[model samples]
Structures are given as structure tokens and as C-alpha cells.
Target: MAMTAAPPRVVATEAALALIARLLARHGPLMFHQSGGCCDGSSPMCYARGELLLGEQDVYLGDIGGQPFHIGAAQYEYWKHTQIIIDAVPGRGGMFSLEGPEGMRFHSRSRLFDDAEWAALVAQQPACFQADQKL
Candidate 1:
């Protein structure tokens, strides 16, 4: 039997990708995390690569706009069955996120995965989750 590839846990809109490219050009490299912190109200937070530390308690949701995205394991538990849609909007994001001063913000929209999608995701092996990633 042939197994189908799981759908990405996270995806970004064209505008988000464009902003990411611009940020990358300015920042050299980047990463993203959403910890439901106070300032952003759960919005995706962008950071320069190595600016933040990733712990085993963080769940790697996957990449968005060619950069890795993650969330606290507790948050992941709440979001595990959903698909995260990343978008760029005009506003101030988290104070610490790289996008705060760019006149744009990275936002996260999510919807629960359908049964088929969930099944496919669950069928995948351990490779899907990144642990203890540096930078």
C-alpha cells in the first residue's frame, strides 16, 4: 500500500511570503514562534535565527515562508488538530518579533483538520516534529 504525504501543519499566504522574503533580506535568517504571549494575543512571532531558544517543550509546527515555526508544547496540545494559516497584515506585532518595526505583522489563523487530514498526519512517523532545533 502506498501512503499519502501529510499536508503541512502550517502554510502562509502570498503576502506573508513576500514579507518573509523582505525580512530575510534584512535579517539574514529568521524563525517564528507563537507562545500565546501577552503582547500579541497568540499571533505568530517572528525572530531572527538564534535570537530565541527552542526547548524540547516546544512543538515544531513546520515551516512558513521557508522559516521554521513552532509553539509551546502546551499551546501545541490545544492546536494539534488544526492547520495554521499564516498571513501578513498591517499592524504592530509582538514587540520582540522582527516584524514589529516593519509596519507589518505576522498573524496566525487556524482551523481544525478534517478527519482525513488528521489521519494522514497521525500516520506519518517521527520525522514530522523537530526537537531541540538550534537557530
Candidate 2:
């Protein structure tokens, strides 16, 4: 048999996707981009409402804590080699983290913090926040 490799699939289930759709439905469009960051040339960031660089691109959907969200196409395109999946654990909520196919890692977006997960997410992204629900 010819051997090959498949890219990582979202770990979340259908229910999660449904939830994400609901959460994002009211929050406006899910946007993504590459920005200069501490570790390297750039990092992936998500916005609840804003103009997207690419108006038409495939968006990734995944759910966390019964809330749905999106990952922008441009962001995925840049980091496809790194596993791109929503970390939908309960307390962790839903956030994007880069798990290198090897070992190193990085993250962006708000940690899937329900009314409780806020503290840690804040610590990680103190200045990056959404005021009036506009991130």
C-alpha cells in the first residue's frame, strides 16, 4: 500500500460545531490574520468583528463548552503544518494553539473561557481584548 499522511482533523465533535456556529452567529464574522509576535515572524489571531483581509476563504468551525467559533482561512493556510484544532476542553474552553508536528508550540485567540476561563486567558492575552464585544 502506498503510504501517505493526512493532516490533523478537528478533535471536537459535531455537537461542538453546532455550538460554535451558535456562539459565532451573533458575534459577527470570525476573522483571522498573521501578526508579528514574540516567538517568530507572526502569529494567528481571531477577531469577533472586523474587516477580514480575505473576504472569501474556507473557514474552520469547532465548538467548545457548547459554544461555536471559527478559524480564518488565511490563518490555517499559514499554519497548516502545525496541528490546527480547537482545544475544546471544559475549563480550557476553546482556543487555538500551535502544536508543532514535532514539539514546540504557540497560541492565539481568546482561550475558551466561559464566564470562568477568563482569568487565564487574560493572563495570556492581557492587552488583546474585546471591548463592547468587538475584538
In candidate 2, which residue pairs clash? 19-68, 20-68, 20-69, 93-112, 94-112
| Location of the lowest summed lDDT over 10 successive residues in candidate 1 | 126-135
Q: Please write out the lDDT profile of model 1 over residues 1-135, one tens digit for every residue.
A: 655567899999998999999999999889999866686678888889989999999888888878999899889777887889999999887878888888999888998877667767876746555342211
List model 2 lDDT by residue over 68-119, tens digit each.
3344566544543343344222322213422222122223332222332333
lDDT of each: 0.84, 0.38
lDDT of 1 at 99: 87
Count backbone overlaps in model 1.
0
Stretches of candidate 1 above 4 Å error? 1-4, 126-135
Per-model C-alpha RMSD: 5.5, 17.4
TM-score of each: 0.87, 0.30
* RMSD in Å for model 2: 17.4
**How high is the lDDT of residue 33 in model 2?**
40
- Residue 46 in model 1: lDDT: 88
By how many angstroms RMSD does model 1 differ from the true structure? 5.5
